[model samples]
Target: MAGAQMVNSHPNVKKYLGFALLPQGGVSIGLLTIVAVQMTQLYPIIAAVIMLSVLVYETMGPVFAKYSLTKSDELYGLDKLNESMFEEDTEN
Candidate 1:
């Protein structure tokens, strides 16, 4: 939700796209790694995928932090600034 506008307008779309995809990809890869670990033949491939997923998770930390900072106060009620739920639209 945070990057919806940036998805279309960001100069380096690929970088933003990668930022968006990393978490999803990491989870999928992590699942695959679990399944691969159960099978004996895919050990090497799964190990590499697990490592890649770790890197992906690391890359996603900042993107996650940015969204968390924006929404944390609203979601957790840590502060009460502008608590109106039905403000009139001021923008055209």
Candidate 2:
């Protein structure tokens, strides 16, 4: 949030900042693997939570991104595509 604020305040290019909330499954899985190898006891609990988090995030990330883009009016091509598809379906 602070970083987004700083970017927005500064003369940098604007960004959707919400993208930062997206999950990093590869890195998390790698670290979790290390934990599993080194600290076997804590691995189960940590792995379960992290895996669940990753699953949820992965599932919802695209939805959130689409919502953000739609809210920002940046999905012009997608909107057009959907309209064209709808028109084609109706015509058929």
Candidate 3:
């Protein structure tokens, strides 16, 4: 029942696909770069760039999520949209 409810609520599987891609996308690229650098004992510059990219994303991600989660605009938008639909259109 709970699984069915969740699927009903989140009708779009694209969200799940998006969540699956996040860590495996840019982060994977960075990890591979770092691993390659260590394997070849090459310039630290490439490794540094990869590490910096990862750190920047890690630092900003939570802040972005928190800000997004706390935003009242979502509730307002939902309420505003629902109100008109539920209310009779008197102008007609």
Worst 10 residues of 2 by lDDT: 8-17
- What ranges in model 2 sit over 4 Å off? 9-16, 75-92
Candidates 1 and 2, the one with greater lDDT: 2
Q: Please write out the lDDT profile of model 2 over residues 1-92, one tens digit for every residue.
A: 57657656422213554653575677878889899999998999999998998898888877777775666556685878899999999998
In order of TM-score, best first, we have 2, 1, 3
The collision pairs in model 3 are none
Give lDDT tens digits, candidate 1, residues 7-72: 664443323443444455556666775777588688777767777776767677668645544443
> Model 1: runs farther than 4 Å from truth?
1-37, 68-76, 81-92
lDDT of predicted model 1: 0.55
Writing each residue's lDDT as its tens digit, candidate 3 over 8-60 gives 64333322333222333366565766678577665466667766766765667
Clashes of each: 0, 0, 0
Worst 10 residues of 1 by lDDT: 83-92
In terms of TM-score, the best-performing candidate is 2
lDDT accuracy of residue 73 in candidate 1 = 34
TM-scores for every predicted model: 0.37, 0.58, 0.34
Which residue pairs does candidate 1 place in steric collision? none
lDDT of each model, Cα atoms only?
Answer: 0.55, 0.73, 0.52
